[model samples]
Target: MAEFFNSISRRKFLLTAGASAGTVLLAGCLGNPPEDVGGNAAAPTTAQPVANISSEQAPETTAVKLGYVPIVEAAPLIIAKEKGFFAKYGMNDVELSKQASWGSARDNVEIGAAAGGIDGGQWQMPMAHLITEGVITKGNKPIPMYLLAQLITHGNGIAIADKWQGKGVDLKLSSALVSQVKADGKGGSRFKAAHTFPNVNQDFWMRYWLAAGGVDPDNDIDLLPVPSAQTVANMKTGTMDAFSTGDPWPYRIVKDKVGYMAALTADIWKNHPEEYLAIRADWVDKNPKATKAILKGIMEAQQWCDNFDNRQEMANILSQRQYFNIPVDILIDPLMGKYDMGNGRKIDDRTMAPLYWKDEKGSVSYPYKSHDLWFITESVRWGFLPQDYITNNAAKAKALIDKVNREDIWKEAATEAGIPAADIPTNTSRGVEEFFDGVKFDPEKPEEYLRSLKIKKANV
Candidate 1:
């Protein structure tokens, strides 16, 4: 994976140069300077149609340093640029920087303090921790974060190496593989699974999937923390046996025929909130207008990506060396809702390609409070936080969670962007409306849900 990334990096450098030349020509024709083509620009007060906007209206942040990785799920960011959504919204100066790892992206956002950073999935729990603990920014100061918007949901999957083939481990075929792991003695076949971070969405789904299958993730297997970009190679080299990560990685494994997608994380929790556009709390507080403008640009990008016609274009951009660096064939399957699992399982469900604002009304409905509670429960279940910590520090934790005003921020931005406010989800306690098997989540009672589970819980 590292080698692949290195090759991708070089390819992106060349592509960036080439793309820059084209941007220059386009800028000249538009009577806009090249410098305003990519970074921070002045914010706009009123909404504007993406198609009619000009570079002169572009925000001053052109050299805007936005961080992202090369995953199929991150199509909105790619589409926004490819389809000129950002340019339409006056984000003409936006520049994308492909970070080496998720950690790198998060760290860069913290240190560089750019406009915002993209998360592989809804990492509300970890982001909450970051705010309270001051690990990334000052804790007491509390970096106010905003959910610019959701990229897509249900695009992530879990892949197990080919060695596990014929072991009847197919996710669609059965949950027998999970049972086998449970039957394995202490450490459960010593299976190793990698995730980008402990607090991200993959971690939540990975742990929940195991527990749902009657396996205690913390005890049944060894969970290794690895960057999402390295998951595939780690599995190939035997450093790990399975991994739950976002698109292109798992899809790449299937393409290589070296691994089989054991389960789609979306299957574990369909329509699950995947990635989010998170910015420093302070940044939002200080640049409310600018923040809204950025959100407008991102919202436009999300709309462009949700259009079926744009899938091919999105895949093409991500396949370029400057972005995902993977073959377009590998990237397109998951993005287009066509799945070819190496184990002879094929899926054509549109559910696979979760979009940001597809429904406009349904997609951006409500911020599921249950989603946040689920992560908190998982943190406790996994010992990332002490049992008493949640209870004793309930006030602090709640304050941290409250700092992420998804409802207010999303509503305001969506309204400003001409997205109907009625479309926003009104029930904050319901985390996700649907799970893989059609289970609904009620975030209001996360503790009860956790206590009902048979999985092992550390005595705290």
Candidate 2:
């Protein structure tokens, strides 16, 4: 189990400020900012009169509200608070608010209802698009959103009911399960899956998985947008024959023997991007230092959670009322790689969780520009973007995608935080993602990919 950091105390907050100021003064005396303060920047030789300023003079903001859902993946935010990591970074007064749903979470951040919000991986792209397209309204003006860091990856999976067992549905491997579903032709036995929202990771993965399995998701099955928390219950009542969702739901279904694992998303696409630390772009510009500090705190918390030894403890923490609010056992199953799919199937596989910090060449920091173009390709495939969107004006499309990359800001913050630039992954690679059936994804050739699909794109 993860060890929770000692909670922040008023004295510790004050002490942190004193320590920051002292380090700055020492750097001034040595004619350089401390290597720990600004890693790669040359030590500044000129000492300004402001060097003597007291710790109390440091900028302090209060009532900084953050919105998040009560899910296991949101552990970093909760840990940062419980561990006093935020306090170490100068955000002493922070409020972690539990949002009612993903829509409310997005609205809270869009309308400045909270300084930031935590949501599923799937929502990140749509949120970026909403901000860029001026679709998110805030005080009658468009609100720009920016991704600060990736919180986790591969925390979601697909669940199918136990009745499908005799019919030959197996989650362990991605064979021709969907093809058999189509051959069954049970009419009303139509497999139904649920997602929280459109254009999020769930939608993309579910769509990709179905497409990879040779089942036309749009035509072969009914796709429904249902709340993540309600997915298991809905499955139990036979409202859904199968669904793709995050940890607790899939774990709950399998534990209750309601469903069998059809496939794990991580196995579908390894190291896939998931949740992100998101904030309004305006807020980012207004408080660059504070934003950097927030990233630092969350980044550290994520590292703390990624340790295998901390899984049980982390699950316990998330199950609290302020967090996921579920039984620790339910939260730990998928987290610990134990799969119990009620109909006599138990497989232990390491499921992907949150991966916050990357250590490359001895330097550690967050992954930037990690959102792939496959999402855009999927958007085109699903008719969310016009067919000519990428081909007719590739540069314009690239620019639209690059607007959400935020590499510049991440680089600046990383530099300030002492992370070496060489430690970050600069190259973005895309190919046809291979499914168990041997099909590959090629982002560079979306047109070819689309042409190869057997199903017709839905009319938008």
Candidate 3:
């Protein structure tokens, strides 16, 4: 049995009187999915048939409006909708609706239970963890959330403008970035860097990148909150020195011939889980069969996304205005892992691509509890959540992790979808992971990891 759910239950997590009454009243709000829910049901996109008729594939809730922000990271969920995977598995009424921003996506889901407009979406993993801890609340009440699975990994980057491009700012290799920043500081220049949002994947990775190079992210660099879509424009206008953000943005800069990728976040940590499908716990509780169906379809889409042959076409499909809205040409290099750093250097390698399925490290989609603990640890380090995110330290952290990991649901859905047991992680961890700067994040010593950080907020 899932111990976290056993201890708290879904009702206690979401329905604490305030959020409950409104959600109960708006329970019948879902109408349909997005406009792309139609088309060939048997189009044979990439993933082969994984399930034979089984009770596990049966969906309870037929319609759901999952929110999204335009980025290629939303690929798996989009593919599940476009390729008819959702329809094939009985969720014929799935819509991949667009949200205005990351914060918007969060609010949409937090109020989803009461408003009943949005059921789930590809969201930041750490933010979901924060919601569970009651840090990211609605009406001062904890909004219960469940991360069913990870959407994409490493489809993001850190990039710099023309000002620092040829000045040698490459992060992966030894560069003069630190020296340049120090010189600039002495010369009365303040270096600024931006990322998508605070307390999320991009923020953590960007800070980790800057800190690794002996620069205090908070104290040394003037950090800016540049949205992913506007990152390139801001960089072009010299709004910030550089940025850490999702795909197409990084690639868009290089395509515009004004900037270059400093480092792909994947190079920081391969197979790192980025965004996750944060579903309201109330939605998951009410739609058990439907939830599994959604997971199976997404798992299959993930498998399809991991397929080597499908990547090129997938990138092209993601470029449509309905999705990422970037041109197909710019997305190809990033999506295909054909990186051009724009510093007279080019890399034609697959390691940096935002892989979906199993690579040498292991499956990228597994919702490992270890990943959760690491996210929580980072969230605390950055003041995104309270230092005492849990009252009992590691024990409380583990309990919160157990509450939201949902690997059991992932394994069950994967198995029902005819996926191999090997793909499903038996252990909660991917072992002790080492970042690009050689800092080891051992999930067991989360509190110790928090203490080891050089740059952190006042509260933590």
Candidate with maximal TM-score: 3
Per-residue C-alpha lDDT of model 3 across residues 54-166, encoded as one tens digit per residue: 56457877788887666767888877776657766777677776666665565677677347557777887676776666655544357778888888878888888878755
TM-score: which is higher, 2 or 3?
3
lDDT of each: 0.57, 0.57, 0.70
| Number of the predicted model whose lDDT against the real structure is largest | 3
Which has the better lDDT: candidate 1, or candidate 2? Answer: 1
Show model 2 residue runs off by greater than 4 Å: 1-63, 114-123, 135-142, 172-188, 341-354, 358-370, 420-422, 428-437, 442-449, 456-460
Candidate 2 lDDT, tens digit per residue, 33-61? 23332112222243222212125423235
Quote model 1's TM-score.
0.78
Better of 2 and 3 by lDDT: 3
Q: Sort by lDDT, best first.
A: 3, 1, 2
